[model samples]
Target: MKDDTKIVHVGRANAKRHNVVNTPVYRASTIVFEDTQQMREAMDGAVGDRKKVMFYGRKGSPTSWTLEEAMTELEEGFDTVLAPSGLGAITTALMAFLRTGDHLLMVDSVYEPTRHFCNGMLAKFGIKTTYYDPNIGEGILKLITPTTRVVFVESPGSHSFEIQDIPAIADAVHSFSDQNIVIIADNTWGTPIFHKPLKLGADISINACTKYIVGHSDVMLGSITAAKEHFPVLYDGRQQLGVAVSPDDAYLATRGLRTLGVRLNQHQENTMKVATWFSERPEVEKVMYPALPSDPNHRLWKRDFSGATGLFGIVFKQTSREAVSAMLNSVSCFSLGYSWGGYESLICPSVVSHIRTASTWRYAEPGIRLHIGLEDPEDLIADLEIALKSFNTFL
Candidate 1:
């Protein structure tokens, strides 16, 4: 069956419980054992498999497994592990595969927290991380060391929006050695709805479900989807780490996923309109949305992805931080804040100079990330126009 039809039916099957379609949120840690053998089986990984139809809750309840199964099927391979946050999805996936003295290759335009995880956590564990240009492609072969175990990526990276040549890099990584090098992609921005990194030779796909997967800002959760070849490593990591999210949080995430498809389509549409408007504005320096024809990565995006989301940024040519602040603050319709992908529009200055390595993020002007939410496009455009006017006036 297709993913769209599967999304509605995959998790909700049992007509036995008041004919309820959604899985009941089973909020319990202790399970009443029927017998010693059953208890023993519960302790084992056998009960945790969704195919088994019986779970003891630490391994994940039916409620959580339903969502995990839904996500795993969406990416077209293997099983999945759930994490408390998006970073959990990334870090746990790394912990699942990498060991001491393993050399890791990461895309230069990676999320900042991921870079911190590489520098601070992995460094202390004797793992060496190497960063390569986002456009490196097959040239990445030269950087791969004998000890290279993982190639971590975040395509159309959160800050600069550089789309890495994932298939080329993955092919290059596998050609050199049969030493089980794992490829990981942070699919938070992709949300599995648009881009399936696993199709491009990625062993693991990580999504911050707090983004489009949840389709709302309320839930904070992360998930890791793995190919069958890599599922055992993730399962082993979960068993060893004893990581699990609360049932309440899992319930919210699952609920949010129901409308993800429609929500994402709207986000893509609204963002395109806003980006087009901003592109024609004199005060705007450049729009960094993949959907924009002017974006450098637009052609690559066209070749790969079928859809775009709400997350995009605009760089304004100016020296005035205060002017930027005024523009952000003066907005009446849109709220100034962080962490988007909610029902409401949000705006904030995202410019940072803390970049240490890789390409300098020096924009032609200071930049602000815009999350086009479920607002009337004209209202949002008017709000932004007035905000730009405020910057004009305040300056």
Candidate 2:
């Protein structure tokens, strides 16, 4: 079935729920069982192959299970586990595969918090992490050691928007036989509709459901989709950590999935309009969007992804920080904030400088990230034009 069709019907109308359209939020810490045998089965996770039956609330309920099932289907993976946040999903995947003496090869352009996790928490546990250039591709194999247990990747990274060669890296990592190298991709930006990491040879795919999947900017959710060989370890790790999504958030995320197809199409349309405007502006140095043919990673993006979303970056022409701030503050249509993939447009400064260690971020000018929302393209462009003009005043 097509993505749009699947989104609308995937987790809806259960037979036991009187044919309800959506999964009802089950808010409970404990679930009662009618028989001791059933209770034992639930406790042992033998009630269902998918573990959809509730034993304890921390394990999951109907709402979260429904969402997980849909996500697993969407990602074309063996299974999925819920996480409290995107970071939780990342940590879960890493913890599932990494050991104390293990080595992790991470993309330099990964989300800042992910870098923090590697540098701070993972380091404390004696797990060594090596951040490599996002464009390394097959060359990543040279960095792999006998101790390398995980290779973490993020395509068209969060701030720089540099598309990585996912297949090349995946193949290179999988070539190691002495140690099992798990490839984990952060698929939040691409989503399932744009890119399927499991098909690209990744062992696991992580998504920040708080963004596009929730759609409304109200719910915080995350998920980890795993391949058949790695699903057991991921599931066990999640259980060991007691990671679970709120039933209400899960329901909201499931509800948002119904319209993700339509919302993404509109988001792509709006983003292109705004990004193209920035490309032609004298104040702008470059527009960092993988979908743009002029972008350095456009070929890789075209090869790997079907489409782009609303998020991109615009580098100004040698502008002062004060000028950039003035422009951001002056924008009316785009709100100055973090987190994208909502109905409302968002703008924020790029955060690649301080967090980067493996590679240098050498932009000619200051840059700001733009998350084009559901607003009319013309109005958004007008807002940006006014903001650019305000920056000129500061200059």
The numbered model that scores best in lDDT is 2
How far residue 29's Cα lies from its native spot in candidate 2, in Å, is 1.3
Q: Clashes in each model (backbone N, CA, C under 3 Å)?
A: 0, 0
Decoy 1 TM-score against native: 0.95
Q: Per-residue lDDT tens digits of candidate 1, residues 1-395? A: 86567767666654246767777888876678789987777557453443443545676777787788778888776888799899878888888898998999988888888989999999999999998888888998998888999999898888677787888888998897677899999887767778889998888999898877777678889999999878978888876787888777877888888888788889899889999999999888878898899999898888777789888888877647778888988898788877877878888887655643755667654578888998888999999998898888756
Task: Evaluate residue 158 in candidate 2 and report its C-alpha lDDT on the 0 to 100 scale.
Answer: 89
For each candidate in the order shown, give its overall lDDT on alpha carbons.
0.82, 0.88
Error of 2 at 166 (Å): 0.6
Task: Supply the TM-score for candidate 2.
Answer: 0.97
